[model samples]
Target: MDNWNILLESTNDGFTIATVLEVPDCQIRDETKEGAVEKVQQLLQKRLDKAEIIKIPTPIQPSTLENPVMRFAGIFRDDPDFIEIMKEIRAEREQDSDL
Candidate 1:
């Protein structure tokens, strides 16, 4: 999962700031807050679609070598603790499925 750090600043109309990818240097922004968000979503979707069609470079891994979540946690995926929590939940689900 990809996450962005959105810095909203109050303006005459509303808030505004650049939406940057937490991992890579990719970023985009719009004058309008809502419009900026929508545009970013659209841009992300386009990139995702294009990524599906092209060969992209793999992201860097974390120091921990548990799973992909741990490998890229806090960088590409998200918070390490949250990722581990989700992993535990998934494990429970899989275990429940077998029963």
Candidate 2:
């Protein structure tokens, strides 16, 4: 299992995060939470061709200081867990087709 570190920063407009995937050479910085996850997936797919390795990244916990509207936007639009779950289901269905 490989672990990745991520940080979420707040701005006047919205929130963004940078994912520290690799040390220096192969790190990916995804501004948004969901984007960071997609970036990690892309990195792994590039590095490892077909080996199944469990990947865990530090989640971007929401901040209470953020505006309610911004927080709501983050909750509904940038929910990485929700997106990932859908992706897993889609992938499972695709694999089942080959059986």
Candidate 3:
């Protein structure tokens, strides 16, 4: 039995959707997260029983601070006074939210 990675996302409509990363066509949705997962498992088993071919997904590369994209993502923190800046921003947002 091949192990596959499943992605679960919660919807605003109060449903959980499950998708098998390796098999794009294999998706299931249910009211609860567990139900969605159970359905996907059964769906996968059925496909396997039918002799369908499914490829195992390649593992995702680990993100590192050394990567340019990752390094650039934190550009806002390059400011020497980032901690104070964030505190002020949060305080302003909280004040606005309370209005």
Q: Count the backbone clashes (under 3 Å) in each candidate.
A: 2, 0, 0
Worst 10 residues of 3 by lDDT: 62-71
- Looking at model 2, residue 18 earns an lDDT score of 46
lDDT of each: 0.64, 0.62, 0.89
TM-score for model 2?
0.29
Candidates ranked by TM-score, best first?
3, 1, 2
**lDDT of model 3, residue 43:** 97
Judged by TM-score, which candidate is best? 3
Total backbone clashes of model 2?
Answer: 0
lDDT (10s digit) by residue, model 3, range 8-97:
999999999999998889999999999999999999889878885659988676654256666567777668698788999999999999
Model 1's C-alpha root-mean-square deviation from the true structure amounts to 15.6
lDDT: which candidate is best? 3
For 1-99, candidate 1 gives per-residue lDDT tens digits of 656565445466554654554524344556777877776667666767766544789876654545756645457366788789889999999999999
Name the lDDT value of residue 49 in candidate 1.
Answer: 72
- In model 1, where is the ten-residue run with the lowest total lDDT? 18-27
Candidate 2: stretches off by over 4 Å: 10-15, 25-31, 48-99
